[model samples]
Target chain A: MNTSVNIAGVCFKNPVTTASGTFGSGKEYSEFFDLGRLGAVTVKGVATTEWKGNNCPRIAETYGGMLNSVGLQNPGVDYFIKNDIPFLRKYDTKIIVNICGHTVSEYCEVTERLSDEDIDLFELNISCPNVSAGGITFGTDAKMAETVVSEVKKYAKKPLIVKLTPNVTDITEIARAVVSGGADAVSLINTLKGMKIDINTRKAFLANKFGGLSGPAVKPVALRMVYEVNKAVDVPIIGMGGISNTEDALEFIMAGATMISVGTANFANPYATVEIVDGIKEYMEKNNIKDLSEIRGIIE
Target chain B: MKKFIFAEVVEIKHMIEDIYDMYVYAPEIAKNAKPGQFAEIYTGLGEAILPRPISFCEIIKEKGLIRFCFRVVGKGTKHFSEMKKGDKLRLLGPLGNGFEIPDAPQKSIVIGGGIGIPPLLELCKHLKGEVHVFLGTREEPILVEDFEKTGAIVHVCTENGCTGYHGYAITLVDELNIPADMIYSCGPKIMLKIVSDWAKKKNIRAQVSMEERMACGIGVCCGCAIKIQKKGEDDWHSLKVCKDGPVFWNDEVIW
Candidate 1:
């Protein structure tokens, strides 16, 4: 398979990257699938400070989906430096670290410290709603989104890709904000804030009361956001949210995304990412396509 | 170890004394599955998504089948108990980490309480030394023949004296009078705690498996985690059972 793709100044072995949080630490996934085959690996959202994250019933199962309120439970920046970073050292794939901060200093602090390490890129994630304040999710407000991108860009020696949320009223405007704020690229459509009611207890299913929703149901909303953002920004886009298979990944690329990430579906099938990667190669081969860039926006 | 799609429904009937006899369709779990390993069996085929995790019991590799004996507790199991011959089940398996069997033990006394006996059955099949198993369930709980087939001397415990020992399994463990070099146990929380505390006092090696709320059956989400201090200080570390372990050295496991 012609499995090579590029983003900004960086290159990936393939276009298949595991979604943050789902590929916890990366070693376990290696048990089922080879980590080196992936284009890049996204670590779980790392917070400036250690967070306990939401309460249990942290995850609840829906008809064909599940909701998780993990509350961004992380081993603080210091711990990540000690524990997580050392483990990623074994993998040869591009390492894109996702960072979350409750305040401005926290974001800068984490990025500044990480600046010393060998990393491929930085994903300024201002989309976690389960946090206190600085997680104001700059992605929701256009101006705030730009400011986060610009601030993190200061210490981030690597290319910056701002991960956006779908809870906003106008997603394109938010995309434009990050682009204007000097973002080298964009990753679209984080999970949507959703809740499920249990008929048994006559209450919310997730103990955290609410969680980010991702799966087939949110695919349309995700696609719409990616389409609008692809048109609004000149930077390359990484699209996500319920992208379970090759057709789904192709849809995002057609809608103007250069690369794609797989979330929620990784749970059902641990090898979902590799399957999508293989599926894409087969799709390209069958279609007689030589370059993935040729179909980046070839929407019929 | 490898993913194979071959699934078959094996009809197993207890030819022993009196017990529930029925056939169940189960996936091959223990071929490459380590001890303390488990699998999820869905009641129906079409996209129910959530499959209940059943600890892998004794395995019969020659027949390409494994067994998991469980008590019918709620809606899911009730549906399973009613399932008879020719019923197909979609199973996702070798799911969680299995028990880490140490190099060797001079002598090990295995303690099983009620439903906990199944996982231990798989572990005992690989033992080299003298192995003594003490099974605790209200005697004649369900399938006595299945327990006996594992080739371990089985001791039964029932509350009303319906079968063997007339008390909790812990009482049976006390009556066993077996010398323990290494002890491994699984079952109810109270039973595990009692064994964990007792083993700690005796300075014996022991490990316990814990069942907590699990969602994805993988480490994607941190749903099932217990606060265990990292073998040192008073500080507690949260470890996910789906990934970190369903098994831990008894002392290292913070109840």
Candidate 2:
């Protein structure tokens, strides 16, 4: 059975890629499972400079999920090129670097710096909800989303995939905006904005007060958004949010996603990605489905 | 590479009200465990999605066993309390950078409060020089005998003065006029802040173990970040408690 799905001109061995920031450049999770088993390893967001992120108490456990305000803490592009790239090169999977920044130039600087790197794709992150300035600014606005994508596309040598945030009024408008600019594909939904309060202390649980929520609770909304964006745009959609099992991945695919990403579930079970991969293969055999294209949008 | 092992529960004992001591037979984990390192204990409950991170109270390398002492705080710890002996627990560990104990024979004062007392036991047992342990709790003190077993001078403090000293653990040190070349501490943020302030005023070096709600006990999830200052840098950088440290020099902390 053919499990491979091509986004843009790049071909992933399978449609299973770890979501950005959840998988730390394939170093920590490599302990439980091999990096090569994945179709692609999407590294955490890298910026033009090192980001200290927010203060402590940055994460809180919510019902059926969790909230985080990690603020995209990373060691910058130089460190990623020196340390993380060499480690990930040892694996056979495709590398999709997620780029984050405070300004449009900051995003282009990272893309330009990584021009000579061995990465297969770039997931331009204008959707991070934790930061105050640039994270959700570009994603929530239609004109801004198109402007950032077009600006980054000029510098990026690899295929550019725009990651969309779900905290917007209308997600399809932003999806169509990015596709109108020069995006090869699109991935959604990047965590919904949420907050948790400590009753005893009468204060917010997270230090940042507001955080991005991800997990099983957000799956239904993600599927609905993916289905709507697929119908609205001509680009391949990478659906993710609260994807825990093979059935969840299948749901995203059936809802018209070309691929699916596993995020918060990795914290619970490190072997979840590989398990879903095997489960997808098992499902194909049972249903006599030859390729993923047959079931890509079967519900429609 | 880090390995997750299924450790069989060898023994479980109720140390005090709501506190439990569980001994697990995990050779691989026990073989490499250090003083301040912790393990992520899987609760096996669907409601509790993330693993609860618990520190190693003791490590008997000869028997290939590790002891974890924890209080039943939430649903996760409650699940651990219900577990029976011989049951296998999926544990991911011996993670995080542990306490650094130099063999220079310096006078060391180890201060721990409530649940924070457990990680210090391993450090006290291994320290070669003069070690004085001061532990404080809200009410009933757990693992006092275990601390005494380490052969260090153990002092206790409770909120109501029902045990050893009155008030906080730092007050005990102040009343005794304890002279120390260094201090090691782990407790609630407020207590640690007091201890850190005392250490700074006295010009004594101190290393503190910090706690945060963690997701991946590994560095992947940037959930457990603690602000820290580098040796020569003036700027504070967010360091992962699970990777950079559960233990950091008191001066490095931004508290």
Candidate 3:
């Protein structure tokens, strides 16, 4: 009957939260459904300063998935503290701020600035592949990931969930690295690097030429990586990528995700997160399941 | 509030090669929808995840119907063109800001190129002034009768000289020497830029509806960001075409 999940002692009302970058601090989607229904609202990446992002044509639709090279366009942590925080505080949901930066200090600067804010968790985004510096640069390399997480951990007051990129060869190595560097929990996998070309134009479909692919297409790879990371590390996993319906969510849960984040599905269905939340409860009631733990990583 | 509903397809018509007109019965959307606003239509195909953002060509509030006139550009639109009447489509809409209508009667010029012509039809119908419509197409012009039905002065220009005036619609506007207090347009970026420039030269207020490759038709995904700067601003900011506007003041756009 219990649906609440605790990650690093911070309890989410349910095991459903939106993926960062997909849900913009729960502002637009808040118009569709009540924000309080979500376990947590993960805001977009906030840096020390505002980012202008890439260029037009930043997104392209592919087979069962989409590619985005938004480059973490944000209004900075100060803007979040001034505008987003107060707005989100009006809701009853937990706030998980996703922090992004170009360097180790930049990440710490944002974390230190937000350390005093009334938020629930800090999702350290060391896995954004769209940016040229400091994002996937730190996430793909185990040593860099450890260094960035440790550096940011010194400043972050709340539980730090290091988001991982799926572009790496061994995702578990990076998972172990972040965990070793004082990460309270970890979330994976971020978008996988992918590209599409316009056959008529003979040019890259996305303005950046390459973008991060997220959707149902990436779900299998994300699930495999989540399972592998779960086996390799003791930290709770927040699984994501291509999670649209409750069944897809349950697959991630059974694959060992402590909490699942809905990404690209939100675009396809604005009510995707809330629907999954309700669907999970309905599923549990129908199956006579007591708690999510009964199904969490049950496949193993 | 935007509603994601299963709208029953009322009618689908193949107006021309690659272009089709689809009408759906969704009272909630039809009641709330304004001209220039768009709907995110899901293909129902599992392979295509993102919905195709199609603008409302017409909103028949009396019958609780909304028409989407779109060309078969890609997989999603092609799928929509193949849909039959009575088929239910997953639609999320009344999204993005629509064109602003002035209160007082004034001279207005509405320009549209190719597929962009459909969105301007509703705006023309709702305008309270002298409406001058200039439609530009490659070979054949569609929606001439629809615009004509609105009682607006409709002018057609074809690129191939197959019909109407020869050359682009903007040139037709120049040749006709049509004077207006405001101008509105929707088309390819290059065409919009020309319209924006033409509006700037005349010192008239102008609004343009932009198009971009979009994932989410909502502002959540900063996918369809268009560079914009206010009149006095030094630097441009990335504004979501889905949320801030698929419609923006022509002068504010960093074209």
Best by DockQ: 3
What is the TM-score of candidate 2?
A: 0.97
Pairs with backbone N, CA or C atoms under 3 Å apart (clashes), candidate 1: A54-A71, B35-B99, B138-B158, B139-B157, B139-B158
Poorly placed runs, candidate 3 (over 4 Å)? none
Task: Give the per-residue lDDT digits (tens) of candidate 1, residues B124-208.
Answer: 8776577667777754554455556656566677777877778877677776667778888888878899998888877887878
Q: Please name the candidate that would achieve the greatest lDDT relative to the true structure.
A: 3
**Residues A71-155, candidate 1, lDDT per residue (tens digit)?**
7788888888888777777877899998888776788888998988877888888887666576645668888788878888898
iRMSD of prediction 3: 1.0
Chain B TM-score of predicted candidate 2 relative to the true chain B: 0.97
lDDT of 3 by residue, A188-285 (tens): 98999999999999999888999999999998999999899989999999999889999999999999999999999988888899999999999999
List candidate 2 stretches off by more than 4 Å: none
What are the Cα lDDT values of the candidates?
0.74, 0.91, 0.92
Better of 1 and 2 by lDDT: 2
lDDT score for residue A103 of model 1: 70
For candidate 1, chain B by itself scores a TM value of 0.83
lDDT of 3 by residue, B21-137 (tens): 999999999998999999889887888878889999999999999999999988888999999999999888888999998888889999999999999999988998789999999
Residues A4-108 of candidate 2: C-alpha lDDT, one tens digit per residue:
999988888899999998989988888778889899999999999899888768888877888999999999999999999999989989999999999999999
Q: Best candidate, TM-score-wise?
A: 3
- The alpha-carbon lDDT assigned to residue B233 of candidate 2 equals 94
